[model samples]
Target chain A: MQYQSQAVAKLYFTAAIGLFAGQILFGLILGLQYVVGDFLFPEIPFNVARMVHTNLLIVWILFGFMGAAYYLVPEEAERELHSPGLAVLMFWVFLVAGALTILGYLLVPYSGLAKMTGNDLLPTMGREFLEQPTITKIGIVIVALAFLYNIGMTILSGRKTVVNLVLLIGLAGLAVLFLFAFYNPDNLVEDKLYWWWVVHLWVEGVWELILGSILAFVLIKTTGVDREVIEKWLYVIIAMTLITGIIGTGHHYYWIGTPEYWQWWGSVFSALEPIPFFMMTVFAFNMVNRRRRNHLNKVAVLWALGTAVMAFLGAGVWGFLHTLSPVNYYTHGSQITAAHGHMAFYGAYAMIVLTIISYAMPMMRGRKAANSNRSQVLEMWSFWLMTVSMVFITLFLTGAGILQVYLQRYSDTPLPFMVVQEKIALFYWMREVAGVVFLAGLVLYIASFFVGSKDPEAAVEQAASPTA
Target chain B: MTRGGSLPETSRYPPGDLAVWIFILAELAVFAIFFAAYAFTRMQHVALFDQYQATLDRNAALFNTLALVTASYFVVRAVTAIREGRTASARNRLWAAVGMGGLFLLVKGMEYAHHLGEGIRLSTNAFYMFYLSLTFFHFMHVILGILVLMVLAMRTAAGHYSAQSHTDIESGASYWHMVDLVWLILFPLVYVMH
Candidate 1:
């Protein structure tokens, strides 16, 4: 809000929320398909629905990161964005491409869509998350290039703060690593090996730098903590992140046809991955405890701290559970992976996007500091509902996974996959119910924006949060 | 970091910034896990480990240990020198520590070349896998420690440290000691333990 060009983030934030809703809806559909088997039948098909769900999640999170950068870079650099016009143009380009891609997934059979999109020339369509056609992938590269150019120019043209520098490094690392997606080796092992350079390197590796910088920016504003203090810790946290995360790539190399040393290397390193997250959790709490002023935006601070704890639990604690090569031997592709995936994504990435949105959205709309008390109350309601529901979903999937692993993979007389799945259908039913509650929370979250536009920001509360 | 205790000067606790201590503890925890993995795996394969343990060149490892221990001694001298306002002496001590670190790396590098000459790799066998992985990991730490010592040496030469303001020296010294400490454990567990 300090710079006129910061207004452009409003457009990207709105799109991110819209696509986030679409993702959760598709997620609910996928969850139902898990329990009911043929509920959607061949009309929408489970595979296509899953693709839509995951692809939408990635697209929306990218939208969120772009929006965050647009808002943050201007303020951190003490200047306007280099070109807000290009920012808006790229938003529309990304949105339209995202929409057309989703439509193609729904309308055409996946293989036929692959053929129609000229998959023969560069066959990148059938991969797990890179399910986008080669043309769309090229479009993504173009959009990313334009976006990086805009942000990069703004940082170089103005004062370079540590936050902006770290973010630039992270964003640049993201673009460079995405080029790995194009390297599709015919050897499945090699293919899987490099695929992690895109996925694991993003979430665990450089993306952490982005997360630390953004969280540092928010803490500086809300807690009035010293920038030097936050910047120093940011360096330590990101250093730990890459130190553990880079070699932490060894975890994935274990079962893949890699060398035997990965067993020790992967276990030792990935087991330490939780340390950075644990430090993040401690750092967030410590900053809030040392706050100088009581900011009006209590909810944003809540979202920030909530993200820290949940990310540690979901990504750190849960990840540590099955990461040891010995333990992974029994639970490689079981529902345990599902349980970890659901919570880790929601806690780490999804909640971060929501945190920045919560902090910036009110100011972009011309509010003084925060949303009205009513809106914040409802947002906190949504926060707990969604977060708690996710916990339930993870626990249910974990329960189903343990049972499935025992009955199907571990027992003396092992049951077949389908039989074990049938025995574990009850957990799936409970998960569907939790997924419904989550949808309700998302509805409340969106409704909060509209519910109190006219009301003044909330008066200061006297009681501090327990951790604070 | 002690609560309700004497202050830093009096207590001599941990001897550096809490941030550096956090990293030091994390690094130690990782090495602890690696050692545990080595011990647990050794328990399962005692004969293989014992048979391969003899193949290691103990003379080179013993010399590397001496090099690291001497480097740590020099770091302690550098910190003490800075505390006494002896800038030139501190810079000389730091450079001496860096030299010792170089000696360790040179010896370790020769050891690696010997292993590679024997066609041994991380995948050759479990014994070789843990041995190479653990030693090479500690070897990287030695290189990093030498870089730190060189930087500290340059800064000391430029008069950046004083008797009252030498926490950076303590922090660097703390880290180098950690690198040395890990090798002390690794040398015995991987190279000498039966």
Candidate 2:
């Protein structure tokens, strides 16, 4: 709102929410396919639906990050964006390319899509999570470059704050590491090794810097805390993130055809991955407690805090549960991995993007500082609804994972994967129910934006100083 | 900014930047979990651990321990010198600490070369995996620690810090001490303890 270019973020956020709905819908379809198996059948198979679900999630979150950067960087730098036009252009390019890719996935078989898209030239398709054809991947790279040029130039030309610097570094790292996704090989081990350079390095590595900077930016605005204090802690937290996370890449190397040494290296470093999340949790609470004045955006504050705790529980705690090689040996590809993936992605990335959107959306829409109180209350309800449902989703998956591990991997006579899955269908059903609740929560979340638009903005009350 | 006044109660203020303390606590947590994993794994394979523990050059580890301890002593002296308004002496002490750190890395590097030359690798055995993993991880910390000390030394020599304003010095020193502290535990657990 402070800068004309900041309005461009509204387009990106609106697109993000739209794709988020698409992601959850596809997620529910995939969840149903888990139990009913033939519900979607040949029309839209589970694998294709899953690809849409996950790809949508990634695309939407990228939109959210781009939107957040567009909104926050100008305010932090105290300048107009270098080229809002480039941002809008790249946004359309990314969205159209993403949509086309999803359509291809639905319309054609994956192999046919690959052949049609000339994936044989690059052959980056068919891998887990990097399933986009080579052409689309190239398009992604081009879009990323333009986006970075726009943001990076703005930050360099304006007041250089730690928040902006960290965010730029994270965004740059994200773009650079993503190049590894293009480096697929016939050597499965080598492919897997570098695949992590993209995946692990993004989520656990640079993306954390993005997450921290955004959290810091929000905390500084909402709590009226000292920027210096938050910025300092930002450096410390991100330093810990890379310190543990860089070597922590070894965790994925284990059980792959990598050397036995990775077992120790991976186990030790990754077990410590939770440290930064724990610090993040503590840092969020401590800053809020030390607030000079409470801002009227209570839901934003709630999200900032919620992101911390849930990230710790979902990414930190659940991750550590199977991070050690011994534990992973039994649980590697089971529902446990799925369990961890669902919650960790939702908690860490999905929630943080939502946090920034929650904070910035109201401002972009001409509110003074916050949405109306009724809107905030409904948003809070949505928060609890979505968050609590996610917790149950994780728990139910964990339950399924534990049972699957026992019956399929550890029993006196180990059962086959399908046989064990049949026994654990009940957990999947419960998980599907939980997924429905999550969708309902998403609906409520969307409703929150429209419910109180015409009402007066929420007012801040000067409560007694809790710290004093 | 002067610490010349009665030092703030430890209850009210931690010694270094609060930010650095948070970093320190995170680092400690990682090391703690690692040590616990080591202990748990060792309990399950006492004979294998003992067999490999014998192969380690305890004398080199003992020497490295002395180097780190002496380096920590030098860091403590540097902190004291800065507090007393002796920037030159503090700089000299930090340089001396850096030298000790260099000695530690040099010795540890030689140890690594010896092992690699012997064709022993991480995949050689479970025992070697833990030994090399833990030691090499700590070794990287030493290198990082030295880099920090070198920065602190340069800053001190340039008169960037004072008795009143030396949080950077304290923060760097705190990190170096942590590196040394982890080694102290690491040396005893992985190298000496039966």
Candidate 3:
């Protein structure tokens, strides 16, 4: 609201929410297919729907990150954006390309879509999470470049605060790492090796920089804490992140035709990855507790605190559950990976986006600072509902995973994969039920924005005496 | 800065920035796990471990341990010098500490060269894998410790810390001690505890 260009973030955030809802719908469908098997056959097969589910998630999160950068960089720099016009243009370009890619996945078979997109020239399709056609990948690069140019120019021209610098570094890193997606080697082992450079490096590596900066910005604004204190914590947290995370990449190298040294190196470093997240949780709480002013945005405060805790639980504790090579030898591709993925993505990445959105959306929408009490109450309700259901979803999948691993991998006479799947159908049904509640929570989250638009902003301390 | 400095010194709390302390704790936690893993793995391969453990140069390790311990003692002197407002004395102490770290590295480097000359590596066996991993990890900390000591020396020359305000010196010195302390454990655990 302070800068005209910041309004462009409203468009990005809105689009992010829309795509988020689509992701949940597809997620529910995928969950049902896990139990019912062929619920949406022929027209929407499992592979296609799974790709749509994951791709939508990645795109929407990218949008959310871009939106968060657009919103915070200007305020941190004390200047208007360099090119709001370019930002708006790239927004549409990225959205349309993303939508078309999803449509291609749905309408065309995998092989036909690959051919349609000229996959013969550069074969990057069929990889999990990097399933985009080569053309769309190129389009993503273009959009990322333009977006970075605009943001980078603005930060360079304006006041160079730590928040701006860290965010730019993170965004730049995201773009640079995505280039690895194009390195599709013919050797399967080599392909898998570099593939993690994109996936693992992003989520575990640079994306953490993005997450840390955004959480810092929100906490600074809502708590009225000194920028110096928060920035110090930010530097230490990120330093720890890189120190542990870079070498932590070895965890994925195990079983990928890598050397035996990776087992020792990977286990040693990755076992320490949870420390930064623990520090992050401590940092968020300490800032809020020492807050100078209690901002009227209660829900934003909740989100800021919730982000730190959930990230620690989902990404930190759950990741440690099977990070060791010995443990991972059994649970490598099992549902435990799925369990960890769901919570880690939702808890770390997804909630941080929602945290920024929750904190910034109010001011963008022309409120004094926060939403009316009714809306806040509803938003808090939605936060808990979504968060608790995600916990259940993760737990149910973990149950199914442990049972599956026991029956299929660790048994004296191991059962076949499909037979184990049928045996664990009950857990899948429970997971699908949790998925439904999550979708419902998403519905309420969207509705919270509209429910109390006309009411006066809720005061921090309610009026004491009524005057006639 | 948040809580410790405000509390009375009688509280027996740490004497540096809280942020660095958190970092130190995390780093220590990592070393602890690595040590535990080493012990657990060594239990299974006691014969291989004992066999390869004999190949290590105990005299060189003893010399490195002494060098690191001497460096840590110099840092302690540097901190005390700064606490008493002797900037010149602090600078000299930090230099001595860095010199000790360099000596440790020099002796350790020769050991590494000897091993490489024998064509030993992390892939040689389970014992060598852990021996090289744990020692190299501690070795990197020595390099970092030297760098920290040099920076502290430079800052002391610039009069950045004194009796009134020397948290930077305390933090840097404390980190150097952590490096040295890890070596104390790492030296015996890896080189002598067979």
Number of the top TM-score candidate: 1
Model 3 local distance difference test score = 0.91
Q: What lDDT tens digits, residue by residue, belong to model 1 across residues A1-468?
A: 789999999999999999999999999989899878897788889999999999999999899999999999999999999999999999999999999999999998999898999999987778889899999999999999999999999999998999999999998998889888888999999999999999999989888888888898999999999998888788778878988999999888889898878878888899999999999999999999999988888889999999898889888988988899999889988999899989988988899889999999999999878999889989999999999999999999999999999999999999999999899999999999999999999999999999988888776663244334
Residue A180 local lDDT, model 1? 87
lDDT of the structure predicted as candidate 2: 0.92
Q: For model 2, what is the alpha-carbon lDDT of residue A166?
A: 98
Worst 10 residues of 3 chain B by lDDT: B1-10
lDDT digits (tens) for residues A393-468 of candidate 3: 9999999999999999998999999999999999999999999999888999999999987888978565212211
TM-score of each: 0.95, 0.94, 0.94
Give every collision pair in model 1: none
Regions of model 1 farther than 4 Å from truth: A460-468, B1-9, B158-160
Model 3 chain A: ten consecutive residues of lowest lDDT: A459-468
Q: In model 3, how many backbone clashes occur?
A: 0
Worst 10 residues of 2 chain A by lDDT: A459-468
